[model samples]
Target: MTHILMIPGSLRAASSSRATARALAARLPQGTTCTTADPGVLPHYNADVTDDAEVAAFIEEVRKAHGVIFVTPEYNYSVPGVLKNAIDWASRPAYESVFKGKPCLVVTTSGGALGGVRAQAHLKYILNGMLAVIYPCKEIIVTMANTKVEDGILKDDTVLDFAEEALAGFVATCG
Candidate 1:
């Protein structure tokens, strides 16, 4: 079975990013399992406490997954602090980090028209620095998140189609 780890950037109740990640997971081929990693449960970045329960669980999730999907909300034109902290935790031991050679995709959502594009770029850079093999498919940015998602579901077919197309490429790439 192909296991995919989805990490949502926002922890708000009924979050659009979380909904989008779930919808994306639904589009994957049969037999592909998608699990979400909640950043809210994680502690702030601290190299000295890598073995903490939360960090340990997060690391295990990353190490076991076949690929990772990062669903993030933009904060000041960058990745949210919570999500970045998860990245920092997974990306340890330099070249030997679990992020090394791991397949990851960044999907950003925002209330604005840009759809957190800047944040996506920033995350890609950080992932690259960690030697993560980011998927080269078209970026999926769900803009106007407030309208696109309702009741914890992505309502726009266009945006979901974009996610579908992107995931197809991701699936192929991983397989």
Candidate 2:
């Protein structure tokens, strides 16, 4: 079974990004499990605090996962500050961190027309710097996300199909 760690870029209680993440989690292949990374426990990134228990545990989770999936929303044409902070924590030791060599997939959601394309590009670059092998194909970008998710579920058949196809592609590529 593939164990995927999902990280949402937004922390809002009703975040469209989180809804999309939940939707993807539900549509993953049988025997694959998805778990969200808890960002609340993560403090601001500081090299001196690398050994913090919460950070250590988060790193361990990333190391144990077979792959990672990021559900991101654009914030001022860039990835959210919290999400970036978490990544910064995991990108330590200069290429020897938990993200190194890990397979990753990025999914962006937005209420705007572009569907967080800028944030996705920024995330791809950041993952590159961390030596993470991001999947090239099977990219998911949910535009007008507000219309796709309802009450924490993705209700649109079109969006669901796209997510399912992208996830299947990721699984096939990794396994």
Candidate 3:
């Protein structure tokens, strides 16, 4: 079975990013398994500390997954602090972390028109620095995301279909 780990960049239970991730997870093909990681459960990043069980588990999730999907929302023109904290935790050993060569697909959502494009760019750059193999595909930006998601799931068919298609292509590369 192909396992895909999804990380949402918001801690709010009703955030559009989490809703989008949930929707994507539910729509994956029969053979693919989707697991969502909660970055909120992790503590702030600190280089001085080591041997954090939560951090270790988070890294292991990335190491074991066939690919990763980041669903994030823009906060003040950048990725949220909570998400960055999780990334920092898993980004140990510099260029040789679990993210090294790990396939990643990015999807961004926003309440505004830009759809978290800036945050997406920032995230891709960070992932590139970690040597993660970013999936080559059109950017998936869900604008007016606040209206597109409901009840903890993405409700926009157009956005969801496009994302699902992108995911299919991404999964093909995972093997």
Best candidate (score: lDDT)? 3
lDDT of 2 by residue, 1-175 (tens): 8899998898988889899888889899988977999876799988776469999888888988999999989999999999999898888888888888898999998999999999999999999999998988667888999877788876777877877987887866554
Off by over 4 Å in 1: none
Write candidate 3's Cα lDDT for 1-175 as tens digits.
Answer: 9999999999897899999998888778779988889899898898877888888889999999999999999999999999999999889889999999999999999999999999999999999999999986877999999987767788999988888888888888786
lDDT of 1: 0.88
Worst 10 residues of 1 by lDDT: 166-175
lDDT of each: 0.88, 0.87, 0.90
Ranking by lDDT: 3, 1, 2
lDDT of 3: 0.90
lDDT tens per residue, model 1, 140-170: 9988887777778878888787788888788
Error of 2 at 81 (Å): 0.5
What's the C-alpha lDDT at position 157 in model 2? 76
User: Candidates' TM-scores?
Assistant: 0.96, 0.95, 0.97
Candidate 1, 153: how far from true, in Å?
Answer: 0.8
Indicate which candidate wins on TM-score. 3
Measured by TM-score, how close is model 3 to the native structure? 0.97
- Runs of candidate 3 with Cα error greater than 4 angstroms are none
Q: How displaced is residue 123 in candidate 1, in Å?
A: 0.2
